[model samples]
Target: MYINTVSHYLPSEVIGNEYFTNINNLSHEWIVERTGISERRKASAEENTSTMAIKAVESLLESIPYSKNEIDLIIGATYTPYDTIVTLAHAVQHQLQIPDIPVVSISSACSSLLNAIEIVEGYFALGKASKALVVVSDHNTAYYNEMDTVSGHLWGDGASALLISKERQTDSDMHIKKIITGGAATSGKAIEAVVLRPNDRGVIMPFGRDVFQNACVYMPKVSQQVLHACGLSIDDLDYLIPHQANHRISLNVINTLGIPVEKLISNIQYLGNTGCAGCAIALSENKEKFKKGENIVITVFGGGYSYGAMLITI
Candidate 1:
């Protein structure tokens, strides 16, 4: 499977550390070091999970000329959706004027997207569908405990959409070379960055330090596993796109693996923690940075202590 196209939508309102200084007890220096985020785009009042996804679909459609009938599947991967069961994918289909296509809504916290990745990969492997869509959206800004300080500075809101299809032919220019995914079972009590209250409950709360520690271990190990499965090591990849968890987790993973910083493509400095959108956004932005036929490893890690990686050759 290959990602045919990708589009990202970030709100116009950007919040810096100074906003948190007045709202909560925090500093830019600390946020920049710990989370690797200098600024983040917060969704405007008009934007929600579904609307954000719609914007991405609009952008994606502009690149690929396709009607809804061509889309056999629409998968929404998000921890924060419009509703518990309803998702952004359905809204996108509606906004795009397509009906009757099967839409699957899935959640794996920060790891929600890789789960969707697996789903798309499998659909192609089984020859079940030709063209598919994976959309992710997070209105996490609304969930943050501005008064609680735990998740205020770390969370941001954004959306990303991707179009993927089965390799029409070997020479078709879109093919998925390999994918390796895994998860680690950390102490359940140690997890954070979860919805304390359901979609209708309390609010979004994240245990920053706890999430960081698990990521340090979870990210590198899975990346190595993905590399090993493909019979290639980290040294072979031209770029590494790890989950945009935080500044500390991303650097620590690279450091632990002994990978050069130049071999990685990171946008956390601009977009903040976009959760599942990180991989799609990073891959899209770094397309020009890679040499043709160069290999790239994209890693996705999330709050449930879930971690996974994908290795692909462009």
Candidate 2:
């Protein structure tokens, strides 16, 4: 599989760390020292997961040379949904008006993006589709409690869209080398570490220490697994994009893998944790910087004890 084009949408409203200090009584210095996030974007009242997803798709369509009718599959991934029934996938399909293709919506917390891509890979392997559209969006603020000091400041709203093809269609296409994903819900404090329950005070992290420990372990472990699956090494990677959940997690993964800190790509500092859209948004942000023959790896870990990694070559 090859990535033809990618795009992202970030809201205009910016929430600085001081905003949290006022609402949650968490000092700016303390928040920065812990998460390294200075500010995060907040979606407007009219904006939601599906709307941001549509904007991202519109941006993608503006750049692609082909018609929208060529897209055969549509998949939406998000844990924070505006409506569980209609789904982000249905909203995107309704906006794009692409008829009669397999449309599905899935959630596995932050790993949903890679899981959705893996589904596209399955479709390609079965010869059921050659071109597909994957949209990932998370309206974290919509379901987060700004007053609860635990995880209220860790979220922001954003979305990303990826256009993938079974065959390379352009000179700039990035090759998908390997993808690996798994669930650790049975192990470690995976189930209760981080959670988002409806009418249960939005998002909360009662066991942040456990979530941190698990992320530090799995993000690097999965990164190495996917790299080895492609017969590549950390030395071959031009860049490593870990889940944008925390700066410390990204640092830990790179240090564990012997990857240089300069090779790390992250946006949590400015955009906060955009849930499953984080890695995809980073890829879209840095799409033009990758050189030919360079390799990039995106590893992720989400709240539901879900983790995944993908190796891509430019």
Candidate 3:
């Protein structure tokens, strides 16, 4: 599979650490030192996951020569959903007004983007779809509790859209070399680490230590496995775009992988954690920096104890 184009949408509302200090009494220095997050974006009252996704797609269509009718598969990924009944996939299809195509929505926490791409790979392998659109977004502020000091300040809203083709659509298309995903729900403290119960606190990380520990271990491990599968190594990678969950975790993964610090790409410092959209947003934001024949890795570890990694070549 090849990525024809990518685009992202970030909400206009910016929530700085000072806002958290005033509301939750958490110091700016403490938040930045712990999570490396000085600020995050929050959606306005009129915006939600689907709305941001639609905007991302619109933005992508504006910059690319792709037509809405050319898309045969639409996959939407998001854990924080506005309406489960309607789903993000259905909403996008309705917005595009395309009929009789397979539309699917999936949520695997922060690993949702990779999982959606894996689904696209399956569809292409089975000859079910040629051109696919993968949309990932998270409306964390919609269900987040500003009073919860554990993860209140970490929530952000953003969305990304990717146009993927079974075959290369253009000379500059990025090739999807490999993709792998797995679950750790049965692992230690995996299920209890992060929780998002609508009836309870919108999003909470009661056992953040456990989440951090596993993420540090699995992200690099899966990254190495995917690279090895592609017959490449860490030194061959031009960029490492791990899940933008934490700056410390990213540093730990690079240290474990023995990659140069400059190869790491991160957006959490300003966007905070956009859930599934973080890595995609970072890719879109930094697309210009990547050159032809460069290799990039995207590894993710999400709240549901889900994890994944993909190797792409520009």
Candidate 1 lDDT, tens digit per residue, 133-190? 8998888876666665666677778888888777543332334576666556554534
Give the per-residue Cα lDDT of candidate 2 at 179. 94
Model 3 Cα lDDT, one tens digit per residue, 1-314: 99999999999999999998998799999999989999999999999999999999999988675677989999999999989999998999999899999999999999999999999999999999999999999999998888889888887899999999999989889999999999989877988899898788678899999999999999999999999998998889889999998899999999999998899999999999999999999999999999999999999999869998999999
- Among residues 3 or more apart in sequence or in different chains, the pairs in candidate 1 whose N, CA or C atoms overlap within 3 Å are 35-247, 193-206, 197-202
Model 2 residue 119 CA deviation (Å) reads 0.4
lDDT of each: 0.75, 0.93, 0.94
Model 3 residue 293 CA deviation in Å: 0.7
Worst 10 residues of 3 by lDDT: 61-70
TM-score of candidate 3 versus the correct structure, residues matched by position: 0.99
What stretches of model 1 exceed 4 Å from their correct place? 65-68, 168-174, 186-195, 199-207
Clash number for model 2?
A: 0
Question: Residues 127-234, candidate 2, lDDT per residue (tens digit)?
Answer: 999999999999999999898788888999999999999999999899998999999998688998889999787888999989999999999999989989988888
